[model samples]
Target: MNILKFQHEEDFAATGANLIASLLQSNPRAVLGLATGSSPIGVYAKLVEMHRKGMVSFARASSFNLDEYVGLPADHPQSYRSFMNEHLFSHIDIDPARTYIPSGNAADLDAECRAYDKLLEEQGPADLQILGIGSNGHIGFNEPDASLSSGTHVVDLLEETLEANARFFDRLEDVPRQAVTMGIGGILKAKQIVLLVRGEEKAEAVKQALQGPITTQCPASLLQSHPNVVVLLDEGAAKWLK
Candidate 1:
């Protein structure tokens, strides 16, 4: 893993955006695996700025998001689909047809998960995948566990994840307890990965992910095994790292 420490979140985001832009320039049809949450909001903002300046073009790029709450409709204000549209897609010139976010409201969830995995298998291995670490060190919704799933599937959100995500909902209870996310194997399949962390709240998670044992108890720790993974962190998030 390559680690880059930034003085501020904006710097981290810009650096990460430049990396993505470079990939898109080299491969216009690059498959981008995206993540949503406060950690990546700045990165998306920078990408939108690049698009406006014509520094990058996502017209031919294909995208797939990391996860979504199982009960939220795509258009729901708190849904990851809506979050992606408002933060990234709406500001760019990317073709809507080339973007994909897993359906959170699928009636047949098992089939939906399988189909999503198949779709990724067909377009992947992803040229780049953006990720965020949960407070408990999860990547996507792959919460701490003895074993992690290996494809897109349902997950019961951990209490730590719910507490961290509650800022987006009206009440703590409004935070969905479950979600659908790409598994460890799916993320490991990506050709390159960028894990973004910001804020002091993420300091401990970042520290453990970088220096602790590779264990399912801290899902993000699994990235230690990936051949190409970049960890971008702001000073606040890197404070605990020795």
Candidate 2:
């Protein structure tokens, strides 16, 4: 694992965007595992800027998002699908058909989960996976527990998770109680992982995730087991890191 602390948000964003751009340069068809939330917004913005400048092209690239809220339509303003479309996909040259986000509204969510795992087996081992740590240290909605799933699955959202996400919704009640997420195992399968963290609020979680012992109770700590991982942190988030 490589931890990089940045004095400025722009530096953090540029370094992350450059990592992905370099991957695309080497492998035009690279598979990307994406995440949604505040942490990754700056990185996505930097990527979009690079795309606009013709420094990177995503025409042949494929992508899979890490999770999506259950019961929300793909078109819902707060949906992960909508988030990706608004932040990265719309501005890049990637083909819409090549991007995948688990269908949160599927009638048979269990089947949908299985299909997602199958798709990952067929098209992935993502060249790069982006991640954001929850204040409680969850990743991709994989909340703290005695054990974690090994493939795509549905999970009950933790209250902390819901409250954190409620800021995006009109009311707390509007926040989805369940979500479909790529499990820890699925996330580990990525060839490389990039973790984006920011804000003073996340400092403790970042400290626990990277410096504390590896445990399912702090899901992001499991990234310590991965062979290749890069953590980009703004000063606020890196405050506790030694």
Candidate 3:
């Protein structure tokens, strides 16, 4: 694990974008494992700026998002798909056909999860996987638990997760109660992992995830076992690193 701390959020976002830009430059067809959350929004914005400046291009790259809300339509305002489109995809030259996000409203969600895992088997071992740490140390929608899944699957959103995400919805009740996410095993398969964390609120989670014990109770702690993991943090989030 390599930890990089920045005093400002802008620097953190720029560093994260630079990493992705370097990957795309080296491999035009790089498979990106993307995450959707506030932590990554600034990074995505920086990428968009780079694309506009011709400093990087995603035309040949493919992307796979980490998770999606189970009961939301792809077109829904708060859906991960929409979030990606509005934040990154639409601003770049990437082909929409190559981008994949689990079908949150698929008639048979179990089948959808299976298909996603199969697709990963065929086109994965992602060149770079982006992640954000939840307040409870969860990654994707893989909340802390006694055990974790090895492939893509559905998950019941925890109260903390629901409350954290409620800010995006009109009402707390509007947040989805469930979601579909790539399992920790699936996430670990990536060739590289980039964890982006910000805010003073996430300080403790970052400390536990990076310097604490490896356990299923804190899903992010499992990244300690990954061979190639880079953690980018702002001053607030990296406060406990020392």
Candidate 4:
């Protein structure tokens, strides 16, 4: 758990992007575990800029996103697929066939989860995985619970999680009540993990995830047990860290 604090957003973005760029530079075919949400927008933007400058290449690289809203079409404006296309995939040289986001609209959802986990087990175990902590300390959609899943699965969205994501939709009710997310065990399979957090709104979560007891109640706290995790924080997010 290597923690870094930054006063400027640009510095925070660069640091996160640097970690990804460096990974791709060294391993052209690197498997990237990506995430969505405001925390990663700047990092994705920086990666796109670096791609344009010829500083990095995703041509041989592949990526897997953490989750997607259940019941949303892949082309939906608010879908994670659409979000990734607009922010990162569209600007990079990566092969579209090589990128993956768990299918949220599959008719057989449990099967979809199993197949997605199978894919990761057979081909992934990504070299670098990026994450964003929920204000409640949840990672992906693995909300606080007595136990956690070990594979990709569907999760019921909590009220706070739904409210936090409601800003992306026209109405709170428009936000999906469920999501397809990689479980904690799946995420922990990555060779490296990068947790990016910003805003004072997340300060308490940051403190709990990094310092509080490792419990299922706070999924991000489990990262403390992983061998390689780099946490990048802006002042606001680190305000409560001791």
lDDT of each: 0.91, 0.96, 0.95, 0.96
Q: Model 1: per-residue lDDT, tens digit, 209-239? A: 8899999999999899998999999888999
lDDT of 2 by residue, 17-111 (tens): 99999999999999999999998999999999999999999999999999999999999999999999999999999999999999999999999
- lDDT per residue, candidate 3, 55-105, as tens digits? 999999999999999989999999999999999999999999999999999
Global CA lDDT computed for model 3: 0.95
Which window of 10 residues has the lowest lDDT sum in candidate 2?
A: 233-242
Off by over 4 Å in 2: none
Clashing pairs in 2: none
Candidate 3 has a TM-score of 0.99
**What lDDT does model 2 reach?**
0.96
For each candidate in turn, give its C-alpha RMSD to the true structure in angstroms. 0.9, 0.6, 0.7, 0.5
CA deviation > 4 Å runs, candidate 1: none
TM-score against native, each model:
0.98, 0.99, 0.99, 0.99
